[model samples]
Target chain A: MTPEPSPSAPTAAPPVPSTRPAATLQRRLFLVGSLLVAGLALSVVAFGDLGEDLVYFWDPSQMAAAGEDAVGATIRLGGVVKAGTVQWQPDANSLKFIVTDGKVEVPVEATGAPPQMFREGIGVVVEGTLTKSGVFTSDRLMVKHSNEYKAPEGEMSAEERKTLYTTVEEL
Target chain B: MNEVAEPVATGVITGGWSYIWAAYGVTWAALLLFLGRALLLSRAPDPEPE
Candidate 1:
């Protein structure tokens, strides 16, 4: 049956006002991004804990370039432990020595049994901060070993520690 | 725990596990912060509309 051609059907969309404004979604995105970046920058500076870039590591040569900035920062300086420079408090538990790159010397003091790999002319990493005397007062000492074998410090250092601490307790 | 506190202790914090943990934390946080800064400064283009 050839029914009469129906008129065009109406769409179900809500009517749009002729004068209504269109939203700029890009503006919202830009604002969100800008605010987030600013927030992160502020936090990074305030908490600087996350910014370990301020942590300094230098040999004597590099340290000359990294002057006042390294005053209070924890640093790691590696070199050979100087011979005839190691001093102890009459007890072997605490030892102080100089680390040299064969050019300049860095003072390192460690207060415990030396690591197995610790020996004169061997590489060591001393972790600590610089003091007013321009000395590296270290609380920790780690030594480098070869062939995957560690030569742990025997009873010599341990005996020294026991004696030192006993004396401290007695005093 | 201390040897003096407990009066007779042998080993408490012997190994360097704590230092290892501290290093791990600092490293991860620093890396994440670096990545965050890099992403914040990155400029990229939007995809084409379907």
Candidate 2:
């Protein structure tokens, strides 16, 4: 007969019930589910914050209709720059202009030089608050160019062209 | 950027379609990658029994 097994001999360790393959799969599924739920929660919060920051683009006519209720709220105003309404005061570092969308006009006051692409008859978007005084106080102005790269119609007037060239020379 | 006393002359801003295209392309690509990963995981072979 085989020699009696020694009483103190070491035996293979028993397999852990909790460490089975099924248990591992369950743990993995729980982790993935938790991650998905966390991601969805994060996405919802981000979208909610974005909703507050999304300024709606409104034309002058729309703004006019909004009346006093629109005051003090930030908005993106889009319209064509009204010709012969631009007044630039270099001394005061202020530029005032009127934006019109044919149906209505809004006066805009800004504290810096207009964008290089800014000119009469061009479309623009101004970001600012509409004051109770019915003036749009713009802090940021962007020129809206068409997707088609076509030459602008008409040439600048002699006086305006001279002023532009002189300004360029100074720079 | 310095605040110029008078408006300066400059060329028209152009050629930004590439950026727009890239933005949309990257978004779709990421979505596709995520979908592919999910499908692959779902089809993965079950672990062998102990």
Which number leads on TM-score? Answer: 2
Best by DockQ: 2
TM-score of chain B of each: 0.51, 0.62
Off by over 4 Å in 2: A1-55, A151-171, B1-50
lDDT of 2 at A159: 79
TM-score, cand. 1 vs. native? 0.40
For model 2, residues A1-171, the per-residue Cα lDDT tens digits are 654344343376444576789998999999999999999999988776875456468989888998987899888899998876777777887778889999899999988877667877788899999998899999898888889875456677777878999999999
DockQ of each: 0.04, 0.10
lDDT of 1: 0.67
Root-mean-square deviation of Cα positions for candidate 1 versus the true structure, in angstroms: 19.2
Clashing pairs in 2: none
- In CAPRI terms, model 1 is classed as incorrect
Candidate 1, chain A: TM-score against the reference = 0.49
